[model samples]
Target chain A: MNAPILWIAVPFLVGGGILFLLRERYAAWLGGGTAALLALIALVIPIDTALLLGPVSLKIAPSIQILGRSFELNTADGPLLAIIYGLAALWLFGTEASGTANRFVSLGLMIVALLTASIAVEPFLYAALLLEMAAMLVVPMLVPPDQKAGRGVVRFLIYQTFAMPFILFSGWMLAGVEASPGDLGTTIQAGVMLSLGFAFLFAIFPLYNWVPLLMEEASPYATGFLLWALPTFTTIFALDFLDRYTWLRTTPQLTNAIRFAGVFMVASGGIFASLQRHIGRILGYAAITEAGLLLLIIGLGSSEIINLTFLILIPRGLELVVWALAIAIIKGRIQSLRFADVQGLARSYPVAVSSLILAHLAMSGFPLLAGFPSRFALWQQIAEGSLALSFWVFLGMFGLLIAAIRTLAVFVMAKEDAKWEWNESWVQTIMLGLGVIGLFILGLFPQALQPFLSNLAPLFEHLGQ
Target chain B: MVTDTVSWIAVGLALITSTAILISRDWRVSLGALAVQYLAAFWLVTRHLPLAMGSVKLIAGWMVIATLGMTRLSLMNLEQQEEDAFFPRGQWFRIALMGIVVLVAAGSAPRIEAAIPGLGLPIIAGSLLLIGGGVAHLGITSDLLRVILGLLTMLAGFEILYAAVESAILVTGLLAAVNLGLGILGSYLLIAGSSPLENEDEL
Candidate 1:
């Protein structure tokens, strides 16, 4: 059996089967179960290597060819697969609780498989096409059959479409650069094109208006899942670019430019996040800030920082799940996610609001939370380089801190006679409880998930400092 | 020599069709213009690819139009069709944008052709027109259907440019799939968005 076929093709087909055959009640279970099983296989099995069990010998080959194109997975990619599918499992399991079980689970599976293919496809340019497919797939999930397509949804599709051709063009140019290594003009153009491509793909800085807009329009849970799933893969993919080309990582100008982009996104995203009134929009900016942190960490451009990135990244999934789920639970009861509408929600739904605030604070990098340790480590590293950049990054985090404070005040400003109560469904309470616990565990013991992501560095050939 | 004339004609048709799609107040005209635009796309793509290969874009584009047309045809009754204006509101503004785009395309095509090498001026010029027109279409429209058409128009332009540089069969097929996918997505969104209105109209 080929590894790519097992990991990519099987799940994609299975997701289709589930979507056609199953009801919503079973979709989440079946989808989450499939994701969990895939994660376990990725964890236990090594690609391109033979495994013997009982009297049988079996090997899962690394690559599969379909229509003259190849999908290849090396041994180092196994852990990455494990981590991705595992994180996806977390999101899938939360769907039942978050009330987006139907399309969220089935399409989530297919989207995950497509993203996996984006990594595994050879010549890698094809990855852009696959990513485009995945982004389009996100639309059906974001806009339910009952809801009208909003500007955010259309904008998301358009921006993603706009990004594909640039990346594709840059990929062709990069091929030219590889052939004539001395062509300075071609190399420079390729880098610029690649940067522009990612600027749209990552929704960096000003291009990120759609994030908050989508947050306002779509289900917070769906938006949160989209935010988690896309950036997680995109960050890995961006880091892949660094790993593949010495010029991308080694050139001081490129690296510095990248670092500046990361800092600027963080600073700008934070300022906007703090100023937002709607909690959904606040979550949107917070996710953008998280994306910026991932970019900043990648700009740090060492294998160790990549390792640190996993620490930042794993907790991010938990934070978003908790935050988005909390919002979903509260939004079910209320009309809007605006601060004024949700004021005093803590009195009515303390568990939901508390989890939301905790997730917000974690994202703010408050000490002793899952979002803190890695960010603190990143802070120390950035301060070593430039205190000025460090200060700005800190200010971004500070803005998140302020937003969390504002959100907290709004949640607690109930009438004096109002009493705290648990309004969450048992399922929501359990899911949110587990998510909050996961945050605390990671915050206290930040290195625990390292085993899943430990070998990710070896997946890249030259990215190690 | 005849083929060269045909290619230039195709380029002109592309620019004209794209402009029509942009300025047309009626969705059917926009769709009809999209159909014609695909023929232009086919001709320009034949600059690098064979006729059979070039037809892939045409086929994919027509398929997109078919999907969108069928959806809109069904849902057209749901929306109250406003009387056709000689130029819709902001129609003059859109026309002005197209004028700028045409000049910009004329100005930039030679430099792009020089930089890329081997791509002719017509291919470069038509692509820029399509891109600029598509962007202008996207910018002026708030309607979901129009936004999608804008995307399709823009993608057609990009497919033509990319066909010149990388003529791999797989790239051709993938681009075709992207076109088809966009069509289906747009159809789905249009139908989904209009259903509530359909329900209301029935009421």
Candidate 2:
């Protein structure tokens, strides 16, 4: 039994089946349940090892071949799988509340599965195709029935599709570079192509215009899932590239480029987010900013980069969920996600409003929230290197903080005659409340994640070394 | 590998038809030209892939054409005028731009071919023309159908180049799936983006 097929393909088949056969209401439960089960299996079932299940011995192999290619998920990938599926479950469970359960749950599962397959595919370049496939699936999700595909969706598709050729060509060139290590031209071309490919994939800076546009056009929940899934997987894929290529990791020029890109994205995303009137766009920018920070973490080229990346990522899922949920809830009540449209919403949906503010604050790295500890570490690291860069990053954080404050002010702008009421459903209340509490808990004690994250760096042996 | 005369003719026809698809005013003409381009591409791909696999590309392309045609019929009611321009005013500028793109692609193909040695000249030139032209179309047009067409064209170019480099059955199969998926999605978007009254009337 191949663990990858079980974890990746099985969920995809089930999810696709659910999309075809099941009713909308059952999607949340079924999708969430499947994801949870997969997470559990990933956590328990050791890859390339035998397990005695009451008298029957079962061996789950690491690699499975299909048409001469292989999909391998080793024991080192256990935590990563657990995390991916676990976060997937979190997103799936919330779909019912967000009112996008039907297709989001189904397509979300398939996207996650495909992304997992991308990671596990033997000829790493094949991952590019899988990523593109997963991205194409996002089109229908972003553009609803009877609606024209938005510029954001179109740009997103084009940009993602454009990445494929660059990556494939880079892979080809990299092989050439490997063959003749002294060839400077081949090396330069490969590096440029790889950078361009990742730029599109990560939606770094200029390519990220589609993000806020997509957030505005698509359902917040669906877009949030896209935001979470794509960046997380792409970062992992980037790490794989770094681990596999000694030249890519060791080059100071590439490291500096990564750092520069990170700082630019963070600074720009935050500044633009501060100027946004729509809550969805702000959250979109915040996701962009967070991605930039993650890139920064990786760019730092420290032994602890992998751990730091995961540390930032774990909290990000929660923050995005909270933010997206709040936005969706508000959107259900208001036709538009603009602050003006949602004015005085705090009086009606205090929990959602507070959740939104808290999530935004956490994203801005406010102390005693989930993002703070990671942000602090990153800041410390950067400050040690360049105080000027650290200050710029801080300015970005301040911009996000201002956005959070402005959002709070807008939400609380109620008429004197307005009455307080709890408009959120029980599910929304529970999810948002738990998410808010989780942020605080994780923030207060980030050590809780150390056990899981501690083992993750070793997965990339070269980088860890 | 030595290039045959028939292969060169097919490659030229493919490029010509691809250009025609971009320039044609009538949607029907564009669709016909697209099918021709696909057939040419099919012939070109046969140079690298087995006949069975190469046919997959042709079949997928034709299916996409059929899907797009059906979608166009369902969504828009174009007049039966033979000489109607797709874009009445911007033809000259588009033609000039396309010409420039073709020149650039033609100029760069040999250089690119030298850089990536195993790929043939025809494949290199065809891929470059299709990709460059398709991207230019994408940049120029905002119409959903045109954007989809541009995307498909770009993918076709990619398929041609990629098929030469990697001949894995699974990869070919997956690329075919992507092509068909894009067509289905493009069709859905076309119908969805149309006026509600038109959609209701069609239904």
Candidate 1 docks at the CAPRI level of medium
Q: What's candidate 1's DockQ score?
A: 0.51
The best candidate by lDDT is 1
Candidate 2 chain A weakest lDDT stretch, 10 residues = A140-149
Q: Give residue A178's error in model 1 in angstroms.
A: 3.3
Error of 1 at B170 (Å): 2.4
Kindly list the per-residue Cα lDDT of model 1 for residues B4-77, writing each as its tens digit.
Answer: 88888988998898889888878899999999999998999999899988998899899999999999889866
Pairs that collide, model 2: none
lDDT (10s digit) by residue, model 1, range A390-455: 998998999999999999999899999998787788988898999999888988898787776568
* Candidate 1 residue-wise lDDT at A326: 91
lDDT of 2 by residue, A1-465 (tens): 788889888989987997788888788999999999998988888778898989999998899888789988989888889899998998999988887747788888999999999989988888988998999988877776767778888889889988988897788778888789888888988999999999999999899999999998888888998999999989998998898888888889999999999999899989998999999999999999999998998788887788789989999999999889888888888899898899999999999999999999999999999999999889878988998789779888988999999999999999999999999999989988988999999899999898789868768989856
Per-candidate TM vs. native? 0.96, 0.96
lDDT by residue for model 2 (B1-203), tens: 34566667766876777677677677788788888888878877888899999999999899999998988887555443324534766777777877887898789989988888878888877777778778888887766777878888888888888888889887887788888887888887776645664443121
Clashes of each: 0, 0
